[model samples]
Target: MIYCCNDHVELALDVIVDEYETFPVLRKLKEEEKMSTACEYCRKEAEYMVEN
Candidate 1:
Protein backbone atom coordinates (compact mmCIF):
# COMPACT_ATOMS: atom_id res chain seq x y z
CA MET A 1 0.00 0.00 0.00
CA ILE A 2 1.00 3.61 -0.55
CA TYR A 3 0.46 6.26 2.07
CA CYS A 4 0.00 9.74 0.60
CA CYS A 5 -1.21 13.26 1.27
CA ASN A 6 -4.02 14.92 -0.71
CA ASP A 7 -1.60 16.62 -3.07
CA HIS A 8 -0.03 13.38 -4.13
CA VAL A 9 -3.07 11.15 -4.25
CA GLU A 10 -3.18 11.15 -8.01
CA LEU A 11 0.45 10.11 -8.26
CA ALA A 12 -0.18 7.31 -5.82
CA LEU A 13 -3.14 6.12 -7.85
CA ASP A 14 -1.07 6.10 -11.01
CA VAL A 15 1.65 4.12 -9.32
CA ILE A 16 -0.76 1.51 -8.05
CA VAL A 17 -2.37 1.09 -11.46
CA ASP A 18 0.92 0.97 -13.33
CA GLU A 19 2.43 -1.52 -10.94
CA TYR A 20 -0.59 -3.73 -10.34
CA GLU A 21 -2.42 -3.28 -13.63
CA THR A 22 -5.75 -2.98 -11.78
CA PHE A 23 -7.97 -0.40 -10.18
CA PRO A 24 -6.80 0.77 -6.76
CA VAL A 25 -8.74 1.25 -3.57
CA LEU A 26 -8.42 4.63 -1.88
CA ARG A 27 -9.25 5.04 1.78
CA LYS A 28 -9.07 8.14 3.91
CA LEU A 29 -7.43 7.82 7.28
CA LYS A 30 -9.76 8.09 10.20
CA GLU A 31 -8.91 10.66 12.85
CA GLU A 32 -8.51 8.00 15.53
CA GLU A 33 -6.31 5.94 13.25
CA LYS A 34 -3.98 8.65 12.05
CA MET A 35 -0.31 7.74 11.99
CA SER A 36 3.06 9.49 11.75
CA THR A 37 3.76 7.99 8.35
CA ALA A 38 4.76 10.47 5.67
CA CYS A 39 3.46 10.64 2.15
CA GLU A 40 5.16 8.21 -0.24
CA TYR A 41 5.95 11.00 -2.69
CA CYS A 42 6.50 13.94 -0.36
CA ARG A 43 7.25 14.92 3.23
CA LYS A 44 3.73 15.80 4.30
CA GLU A 45 1.79 13.59 6.67
CA ALA A 46 -0.21 10.93 4.93
CA GLU A 47 -3.98 11.34 4.86
CA TYR A 48 -5.00 8.39 2.72
CA MET A 49 -4.08 4.81 1.97
CA VAL A 50 -3.93 3.59 -1.60
CA GLU A 51 -3.86 -0.07 -2.42
CA ASN A 52 -5.21 -2.77 -4.64
Candidate 2:
Protein backbone atom coordinates (compact mmCIF):
# COMPACT_ATOMS: atom_id res chain seq x y z
CA MET A 1 0.00 0.00 0.00
CA ILE A 2 1.16 3.52 -0.74
CA TYR A 3 0.72 6.34 1.74
CA CYS A 4 1.43 10.03 1.53
CA CYS A 5 3.17 12.15 4.11
CA ASN A 6 0.01 14.07 4.96
CA ASP A 7 -2.45 11.21 5.14
CA HIS A 8 -2.46 7.75 6.61
CA VAL A 9 -4.63 6.10 3.96
CA GLU A 10 -3.13 4.10 1.14
CA LEU A 11 -2.62 6.02 -2.04
CA ALA A 12 -3.77 4.72 -5.41
CA LEU A 13 -1.89 4.87 -8.65
CA ASP A 14 -2.65 4.14 -12.30
CA VAL A 15 0.35 1.99 -13.06
CA ILE A 16 -0.13 -0.60 -15.79
CA VAL A 17 2.32 -3.46 -15.55
CA ASP A 18 2.56 -6.87 -17.13
CA GLU A 19 3.58 -8.24 -13.77
CA TYR A 20 3.44 -6.89 -10.24
CA GLU A 21 6.95 -8.09 -9.55
CA THR A 22 8.27 -5.91 -12.35
CA PHE A 23 6.73 -2.75 -11.00
CA PRO A 24 7.94 -0.49 -8.20
CA VAL A 25 11.57 -1.41 -8.38
CA LEU A 26 12.43 -2.42 -4.86
CA ARG A 27 15.71 -1.17 -3.49
CA LYS A 28 17.51 -1.26 -0.17
CA LEU A 29 16.92 1.91 1.76
CA LYS A 30 18.74 0.69 4.83
CA GLU A 31 20.58 -2.30 6.17
CA GLU A 32 17.29 -3.92 7.18
CA GLU A 33 14.71 -1.90 5.31
CA LYS A 34 13.77 -0.75 1.82
CA MET A 35 11.48 1.72 0.03
CA SER A 36 9.67 1.66 -3.30
CA THR A 37 7.59 4.71 -4.09
CA ALA A 38 6.22 7.96 -2.70
CA CYS A 39 3.29 8.42 -0.38
CA GLU A 40 -0.10 9.86 -1.28
CA TYR A 41 -0.53 11.67 1.99
CA CYS A 42 1.90 14.53 1.67
CA ARG A 43 4.09 13.63 -1.24
CA LYS A 44 6.72 12.22 1.11
CA GLU A 45 8.51 9.78 -1.14
CA ALA A 46 9.60 6.84 0.97
CA GLU A 47 7.69 3.76 1.99
CA TYR A 48 8.39 1.01 4.47
CA MET A 49 7.60 -2.26 2.75
CA VAL A 50 6.89 -5.53 4.47
CA GLU A 51 7.60 -8.57 2.38
CA ASN A 52 6.06 -11.87 3.37
Local accuracy of candidate 1 as per-residue lDDT tens digits, 1-52: 9999999999999999999999999999987545677887887889999999
For model 1, state the Cα shift of residue 35 in Å.
3.6
Q: Which candidate is the best by lDDT?
A: 1
lDDT of candidate 2 at residue 7, scale 0 to 100? 37
Per-candidate Cα lDDT values, in order, are 0.91, 0.37
What TM-score do all the candidates reach, one by one?
0.88, 0.25
Clashing residue pairs in candidate 2, if any? 3-39, 3-40, 4-39, 4-40, 4-41, 5-42, 6-41, 6-42, 7-41
- Segments of candidate 2 deviating more than 4 angstroms: 4-36, 50-52
* lDDT tens digits, residue span 1-52, model 2: 4433323322223231223443443322352332545654455654443221
